[model samples]
Target: MIVALTITKFRSFTIPFAFIGMAVLRLPLWLNKRCRFWKLMGSGKDAQVDLPADYRHWAILTTWDNRETYDDFNFRSFVMKWFNFFGSESFTILLNPLSSHGLWSGKQPFKTQISDINHTEKIAVITRAAIRFNKLKEFRSNVKRAAEAMRNATGFILSAGIGENPFFDQATFSIWENMESMKAYAYQSFDHSDVIKLTRARKWYKEELFARFAIIDSWGSLNGVEINTNN
Candidate 1:
């Protein structure tokens, strides 16, 4: 099923550029080399826009075949190299089609489907971590497990890197089918609960942010889209 991935960062000029130079440039190359990588997911027709000055970083939106493909890419490429490079954070939100949609300067109204589910539910998972320099490795490990659990859970659609600068603490975004599925894995699942417990017990993060949104309207590329003003 096609899924949407969104990567955003807090405000910083140098940090985002560094990510562009390093992670962004290498990502397409890495995807090309990977066995399960699909086509680049984005809008080629429109000119890319700059992130607002008020915002720290821009959001990268893309689509994938399924959660498995996305997970493989993350484990093999992103977690190993990309995550370590920039102090970035991300949140992923799963989107279901609300109505017939189309792009490319008004073609016929494309018949829309959820791609995963029927309802138009969009859940966003946002996580940020602050770890002691000495415990960075440990923090990374824990976060990795949490991410993996999230991937394994049912109703997962897409997950992405959060911020542009991740040297100190990092964030991640994941999309889920519904709040119930998200809560089941995040709050009830065994391994995931352990990760959460460790995060709190060890004081791994200085601060974290999380919120959920229902997709009201979406336009643009899969890697990035313009959410509706109503949302």
Candidate 2:
């Protein structure tokens, strides 16, 4: 299976149109039988979950049967057309799951089982959670510091914050130079590690998903800069 993630930035004045697309685009996506699962999400102000969403930015995450299926959707889907006309900039990455654990809305979205891939390969990580209503305050208090620590870590590339709802559902999509580099930050960074421990101790999430992917392809630009997924 292939996963396609697209992050688009709409013009300030066209924000309303982008909002409309979120509701309207669901129809065609649901009608496409080739698509296994999908999520239409809004973005955070920076690379981590934060108060006040980035009104001009949004994202779509979809799982497809294969590369051909994604190609067909990319070339002809109304979803693409909507972004092409309304978005000022966009970036998309095509991935194959390396390993996945936990649940996303009660289902496993990524199906790849290859966890023994080379450590030198570029890696993509997706960490998402449905925060418990009562734990929102604690979750928010710690996320920003962890996010800031990550940005200064070695081999870090880029990331975007995405979720179904700005408040309850939160997720982070990040890319790193390799597994070692990614693990270093995930395991060694004090702030991030502390937050991880707190989450388990406090039981902050109602549901969560943590998955890794091998970056197969990428295109377009984000904020006017293209990402080199292969390197």
Candidate 3:
């Protein structure tokens, strides 16, 4: 299976149209047999876990049958046409799952058999959770510190704060130069480590998913600039 995450941006004047696409684009995606799992999401400012939302940016995370199936939909479907007409810039990254654990909506969307991963290659990580309603305040209060830690870490490329619902359902998609760099931030950063501990001890989430992928292909742009994935 292939996972594709596409982030699209709209101009101020076109924001309303782009927001409407979140609802209208669902029909075609649901009808398409090639798509297995998908989520329509809104983005946060500066890719941080912020309380206020980024009105102009949105994202689509989808699991497909294969690269060909994704290409077919990307080129021939109403989704692309809608994006082209309303969006000012967009970025997409195709991923191959290296390792995945945990559940998303009670199901595992990314199926991976590969156990060994090359640590030197560019990598992508998706961390998402459905926060328990009771723990909302705790979850929100602690995430900013971790976000701040990650923003300045070495080997960090870019990240996007995305989710279906604001506050309660949240997720982050980030890229790193290599596994080592990503691991350092995940395990070594004091602020992030503290949050990790709190998450387990506090049981902040009702459901959660953490997955890592090897970026196989990427194209387009976000925020008016193309991401440099080169080593």
Q: List, residue by residue over 114-176, the lDDT tens digit for candidate 3.
A: 653655788889999999999998888889889988889998998889988877889998999
Quote model 2's TM-score.
0.96
| Models ranked on lDDT | 2, 3, 1
Candidate closest to the true structure, highest TM-score = 2
Winning candidate number (lDDT): 2
Steric clash count of candidate 3? 0
Tell me, what's the RMSD of every candidate?
16.1, 1.3, 1.4
The per-model lDDT (C-alpha) reads: 0.46, 0.90, 0.86
TM-score of model number 3 = 0.95
Q: Candidate 2, 147: how far from true, in Å?
A: 0.3
lDDT of 3 at 205: 91
Candidate 3 residue-wise lDDT at 158: 86
lDDT of 2 by residue, 93-169 (tens): 99989999899999999998567366578899999999999999988888989888888889999878899999899
lDDT of 1 by residue, 17-102 (tens): 53454445445645454332221221111111111122334444333455565556555655324433452444334433333322
Error of 2 at 27 (Å): 1.2
TM-score of each: 0.46, 0.96, 0.95
